[model samples]
Target: MRRAAPLALLAALGAAPLAAQDSAPCGGDFGTFLQGVEAEAVASGIDPATASAFVAGLGPDPEVIAADRRQGVFQLDFLTFSRRLISQDRIDRGRAMADRHATTFDRIEAEYGVPRGVLLAFWAFETDYGAVQGDFGTLDALATLAHDCRRPELFRPQLVAAAELFAMGEIDHATTGAWAGEIGQVQMLPADILENGRDGDGDGRIDLKGSAPDALMSGGAMLQALGWRADEPWLVEVTVPDGLDWASTGLNHPRPVANWAAAGVAARDGALPGGGPGTGLEARLLLPQGRNGPAFLAYPNFDVYFEWNQSFVYVTTAAYFATRLMGAPIYLAGDPDPGLSGEQMIALQEKLVARGHDVGGVDGILGERTREAVQVEQQRLGLPADAWPTPALLGAL
Candidate 1:
């Protein structure tokens, strides 16, 4: 759910030769780089023998580097990505995994105060419960990104951490794969493995390779660190008034239920949950598909879910999947803005820019800023200011 910055996308687009050029700073000599990294690892408390063995004869993986360069295309509309990621197959697999690992999951939940269903949801979403944890070398991926000029400042430290992991004998050069240099069942980065990885199975090493216990426990620890509240719902379906002030609901904004109810918002069914009208738990009303699709009142824990992955669709899908694993219903409605396609969306951005609106960039993606601009344009055109982009709106522009 990591939201790539525009700079990251730009780097991805311009990566091939630039990545090669950036590697020159390390002198096009993998052996020297390995030696230097080993020296640093020893200085940072790694054993000399372990460092030597781990950093021996490693080279840049061109395949992994090329894959990094092509990550720009992975960005998709939130709902689209969610629908594919949280499919029925994944849900059924998660439920089965939950049942298979019931004892381990129960222990993790009791210890970490995270629900088993939520843990299973992350398990299913991240690496399919340890079934398909990519096939790239972690050291190669981190080193390539670190050597690349795009975000060396960010990835270099991770490279150092990857070296340290090697020195610890936690992972070898051969058995590692992750898009952003993460590894194992939960797709944890090297730094995360170093800091938060736990020996849940008590087998001496905290191996996320095939250990469900290690993966689930480590994921629970990460979520706990991100401020996940025990036993609190991340989000609940809600119904908003037809004439509600849609502009008031933005990311991180809070509105009490009393205030929302006064404005004619209500629970999707009949009544609110156990919490009082003014329970002091501030919530944000989100209309992801403008006002025409299903609505949700997101709680603080929902933001915690976002920390795991920044995409709204990702968090919502995780929450929804968790609910499903707990016997809750699927979403009552579908995406409202079904007409918007990538090319059409990009065209809309071009038209918006032509009209003197600064939409950040002419990317096809409709982020919060783009949605706001679309809303403004809709108002100016005497159309519904629901912020839902359409082909008709594009032609009119």
Candidate 2:
């Protein structure tokens, strides 16, 4: 799910008032909690009447809490997640949307340095090109999460920002969106909308839900604000030679393109982009499913994907799908070694935690910290440090 822009950036955008609040006790009467939220919102510059009406009759949304607790879908492996999302229908529709909004796309690229594929890929994944933004009430979801004590510090400020949006007449208590409170076609949180939203349609109002240009442009602006390099390649499919040192392969180990090229990493279709000699572009070798599976050279631009979403599977899929939308050929999915099941992953994480390795949580998801710990364990076990957990690795541990 989407979060607000990074706190540093949010502060630069004058969002300090909302972020400065200390965490209060959670899990009490919903009405009393909302009263405090409303008072806090007004203190954070929300109009009094707006804050009152925004929280009027608001209660903790049980549906939001239930949805928050049910996120096992992220446990799917990279191939499974990418295959489920990057459908032929999505590709065709994405191209159609790009062509339909050529002028807006051109303007966004010229102004924000973000291509149509990047925006369209996110638009497709987020809401199927604005087809199915979530149905949860945005205000209720934010307020509920704010008072739920699970991640109150994160969601409480978002609730205040949504109240500020309500004050601006941008959204209302009935605004429906993702269960995490991300709204509109591109699924942005309220603070992000407030900071980076644009009126691309020239109607003087940023209507991300009703207007395609508005949503696409606002997404482009957000990416630019998140540090997208102009006219840079984010991900490139590549063929890796055997006997390569697998320990140095991951998003954490970025090497110069020339160095990687000299080491025998070749682009699948064309010559490796070495940033034209001495430009010093770097890339990290990424093997999402291990050395034998689909491989990529994820460049610096690809790092911006994490700022958009934290799920490695989702970000990699979105980056690769952006390449697909830009006319890259379908990737060759090679025979990869079997990965751990969700239960096995959880067990492995528990073991890692016992051994003083922080896997970020014992959730089934193979996040970056988990991957780092896995690589270390694989190295200690004299296995290939491809960072992909397998049955053998688990048995050894």
Candidate 3:
């Protein structure tokens, strides 16, 4: 499915096609920032009074800025991320939670066709099954992000959406959530809530924070709206045969399940997750850790996780944990390569760019562009184009 960057809607801020926002240019003058936000709100037809009150009352959350600065996804390895995220305790708890909420999940699947495992995994990971949604006020966190120019283009629309929500009584200034103004059990961004948030509990109000039914139903609704398929498994862990075509793995290399079986890809349990006898479902190979780590057959539904969060570690972990909720084992590879530091990743990205590939601006992050570029470089060198970065590739590059 076509997707925007997670959390924030960047296009609605200024019709001027603003450049990528990565600088914190929101100088200490809070009043000036409010004036600009006020002007944008007025132009966007948001209630001026609601916008002014929110902007006027918003306080600078230095802790939010500090937390943003410390988030370093580029430096994480798959094993580390998975180990930290999917503990045995968490899996057991998730299984229990799934059983407890089976009725609701079944209802959602009967209606929306999106699986309960997917929703359950996100619930566990995003907010620990609603036990820890967040502690910051939504308005305060949103104001901090929108007022700060580092991501104003992204958060500005969120601010406008918040104003509209407030005017309509969807949220209040005291509504608390993540530092980025994400609320609800799933930590949904403001814009998505405005678009797909629903009243699942029949309460006449959408209370994502306090109501599990509302959160799951709305989450299911959003997934279906984005084209979630009932019959497809988002991803499945599998054992790729010895010396399999390593270069032939990636989201770009989709093939039929029959073709994958012919080419030596087998599900961990000898039966594919979404494939029955002669199911002929399509999937692609995902080698997140080059040829040495565990492999997966990712389907179209896998891309939707990126809709929730673009971080590979995050989306993959969510998928993995969901599978575990179905009794899948840990990885077959059993280990991940000790990964890169942020500076090292930046150097790798720079090298990839110098070799005439667009790795999305040398941002130290190994997003899709960087992974694809690495695939090209690997093919050029006649190595397995696993599309995963390695210390060896960094040195060679």
Candidate 4:
């Protein structure tokens, strides 16, 4: 799957490209910032009235800034995080929803090649199937983030896109959602709605909040646009043999299924998918925690999950939950070694950064890039190379 960065997302949507703003001022006078945002929205084809109204009384939201800063929940290990999220209640509800919207899901599969479980996983996680979309004022959240200077380059265009959406009457000042300015049941950014939103119920306008069909269809379409392959598996549980070359695992190393099978990697249940007839399918041996924890073979379709969300644990759990909803059995959680605490992780990241490795912001999350760096250092130190950092590795470094 192609990973669409912010600029790539704009290009794919045919939205007006934002000029480089690395040197642009942020957190200045709110009025002055709104003037520039309004001008950009107008240049991007939003009516001047709409843009002006969108930013007329907007002010920085302290709550939004706090939410952005306090994402410590993401620091949890995969097993703990997934255990909290993948409850029996959610699994049951997801299956019931799939049965309720069987026809719509079938149609989405036919049209977009995205399965019901994929959309349902996101729906269940994002807002509990639309039951609990946030209450932050959408425009206020966007404007606040756009002017906050922490991530102006990312949020500024989203604000303009929200303005354009307002002009199209898709959203209004009364619209509310996630603190990060994602709107509706699936919690989509404005650019995402403008780019991939679909009206599955044929109501003409896309209403993701009130319309389950619209949200599901729109989510499916977005996944398709993100390069979901038709009829491909995303993730499958597997058991890796002892003494396997752990350094050859992770998403960075995608070996053929035949190679993995030959290496004694067996599926937990049923026959493994062999990419039927002439398609050389490849998969990454993913050990989210360590060699001793639950393992999975992540396929190409799995990569699209990252495009949906950056958190490795969240994406893996979401993808695994999708599989469970599809009748897959529960995973086997082996006794993995205990992981480092948040502070230890920060110290490890500092050491890695000093050694010229980019762990992608060093926020103490074991993200993919961080895992890759860990594996490289593990191999260098003659450790297990499972990419699960421990106190020993930290002390050794």
Number of the predicted model whose lDDT against the real structure is largest: 2
Model 4 residue 366 CA deviation in Å? 0.8
Compared with the true structure, all predictions reach lDDT values of 0.69, 0.84, 0.74, 0.83
TM-score of each: 0.81, 0.92, 0.87, 0.92
lDDT of 3 by residue, 149-251 (tens): 6667778778878877886788887888776788888777788898889888887989998999899988898888877888678888887887788777887
Q: Which of the two candidates, 3 or 4, achieves a greater TM-score against the reference? A: 4
Q: After superposition, how far is residue 353 of candidate 1 from its true place, in Å?
A: 6.6
Which residue pairs in candidate 2 collide? none
lDDT of 4: 0.83
Q: Candidate 4: misplaced stretches above 4 Å?
A: 1-25, 275-277
Give the runs in model 1 whose Cα sits over 4 Å from its true position.
1-56, 69-79, 269-278, 349-363, 372-387, 392-397
- Name the weakest run of 10 consecutive residues (lDDT summed) in model 1: 3-12
Instruction: Please report how far candidate 3 places residue 334 from its true position, in Å.
Output: 4.3
**Tens-digit lDDT track of model 1 for 61-161:** 77655554443333354455556566677778788888888888888778777888888877676667776677767777777666655556766677778
After the best TM-score superposition of candidate 1, give how far the Cα of residue 303 lies from its true spot, in angstroms: 1.6
Q: Candidate 2, which segments miss by more than 4 Å at Cα?
A: 1-25
RMSD after CA superposition, every candidate: 5.3, 6.6, 5.8, 6.4
Candidate 2 residue lDDT tens string, 144-258: 8888876888888888888889888899877888888988888888999999999999999999989999998999999999999997899999999898899999988999988
| Span of ten consecutive residues with least summed lDDT in model 4 | 1-10
